[model samples]
Target: MVEDRRLAVLRAIVEDYVRTEEPVGSRAVVERHGLNVSPATVRNDMAALEEEGLIAQPHTSAGRVPTDKGYRMFVDRLTTLKPMSGAERRAISTFLDGAVDLDDVVQRSVRLLSQLTRQVAVVQYPTLTRSTVRHVELVTLTPTRLLVVLILSTGRVEQRVVELSRSELPDADALAGGGGPEVSAGDEPARVVDAVVADLRPRLLGAVVGKRIAEAGAALADLPAAVPDASRTLVRRVAEVLGEAMSDHHADERIAVGGAANLARYGDSFDSAVRPLLEALEEHVVLLKLLGEATAGGAVTVRIGTEGPYHQLASTSVVATGYGPAEAPATLGIVGPTRMDYPGTMVAVRSVARYVSRILDDA
Candidate 1:
């Protein structure tokens, strides 16, 4: 019972410190909270908490503040995350449901999180390796030039231009007997591009359905055989261009961040941790790794000050969670000072992540 009462004192201290951004004193705790205890008794509990390294007195006479260890204990011991209000849940769903596509969903989520938590928010794009092809469009620009467009289920599009080796059009006599345009060395490549586009349109690029961009590209390795002998060269070039476009998509994974201005709210209180955090936020790789560390198990993860591997972020805390399918989930989270509203922020992060996952699942 004594240890439990001490923990209650520690919790009171943390709550007051977060609210006022000032060290909490025994008098203030007794006055602001109904602990039903005397000032002297609270003081003794505070002393015990300090002895355990959970609270610290910044100066000789100032009240105590919860240390990083204290915050970790609070988070670990939290039995229930604070629930969002009815208005808050409605607003989140309304805002996210307005998103038209995957990129829009990511952008909207970053903005929503920042607004909800009043903290910097980071949201990663769906991985290309996990997205399937949505559409493939081939447009002829000239007799020897064609544009190949690859659209993915994640709403990412890639385009490339494939130039034929031949200067002269294919022979028209070869295609004379068919319902389509005649094909030969002297005939325009546009004829073949047009015919192939029509054929593939009905098929809906079945060659790439359900497979990742890279896998789809590989499956089309023998595309040349699917076309007439006269169009063999053009088919091969189209496949090659599609493969290159997939390579480009695989190299570009992106993330969105917003609400950096919120960090300035800490002012002098976070002087030690703000500068490096601002710099690290500018780097996508560092942000990705941070979020990656949290969502490794596809659950909500909280990293308090000094818990994050980097020394510079020791004064900041991260509340993050994974969104999307268990097979290929993405990360979303907020970054703030250690003396933050943990319960509220946890609710916001976890709630937003679930909404995002729902959006992706439906898409």
Candidate 2:
């Protein structure tokens, strides 16, 4: 019972400190929270908490504030995740509903997280290797040129241009039909390219549909052999280019960061933690590593102070979670000072992550 009371005292102190950004005294805890105990009892609990290194008096005679270890304890002991308000939920839905594509969804997610958490937000694009192919579109730009668009289940799109030649399209002249007056030089290219797309679309889709990018590329490797002699060379070029596009994963591994200005709210604390964090945000690899290091259980993960490797971020905290289909996970999270509202921030991160997952699932 005594230990429980000390924990309760620590919880009150952490909450009060986060809210007020000041040391929490025993009198203030009793006044603000009806602990059903005298100030003397609370002070004894505070002394015990300080002895345990959970709370500390910064000044010789000041009230106590939570340490990094204390924040970890608070996070671990949190039993219930605070739910976002109805208005907040409505805002998330409304704000995210208009995203037109994966890029827009990522951009909106970063902005929405930053706005909700009042902290810098970082979102990693969906990992393409885990994503299945959605569609393969072959657009006939010209008789010698085709545009290969590789669309993924994650809503990411990659495009590459394949070049064909008269030699590749031995049937080019045949497609022009004896150079009829109606089939001008310019018109002949269009006619042949259209024929190429019509022949390749279904075949290309068959090779890539429902497969991961790398797997789809492997499946497509043999597509040139399947093409009829009429367009073998042209089809071979298209297949080669499509394979290249599928293997391209640079965009999939990217990270988008927003709300660096929010770091300015740290005020004089900027030099201590906010500055390096801003630099790290610019280096997306750092942010990706930060989110990558987050717990992998799809639950909200909080890394407080030096719990993270970057000593420069010792005064900062990270709250993050994974989004997207369970098969293909992506990370999103908020960065803020250790003095943040942990319960509220965790709820916001979890809510946004869930909504992002829903959006991707719907996509």
Error of 2 at 44 (Å): 0.8
Clashes of 1: 13
Instruction: Give all candidate RMSDs, comma-separated.
Output: 3.5, 3.8
Off by over 4 Å in 2: 141-147, 159-189, 250-252, 293-297
Q: Tens digit of lDDT per residue, candidate 2, span 1-363?
A: 998888899999999998888899989999998898999999999998989999999998899999999999999999998688899899999898888788899999999889888999999888778889988888877777778887788877778988866767646544444432123234455676676678678888888899877788788878877755556677778888877776767465588888888888778844688778877877877787777544323788899998886888789898999888655678899888999999998898888888877877787
Q: How does model 1 score by TM-score?
A: 0.86
lDDT score, residue 33, model 2?
Answer: 88
Candidate 1: what lDDT?
0.79
Error of 2 at 325 (Å): 2.1
- Model 1 lDDT-worst window of ten: 179-188
**Residue 44 lDDT (model 2):** 94
Q: How high a TM-score does candidate 2 get?
A: 0.89
lDDT of 2: 0.81
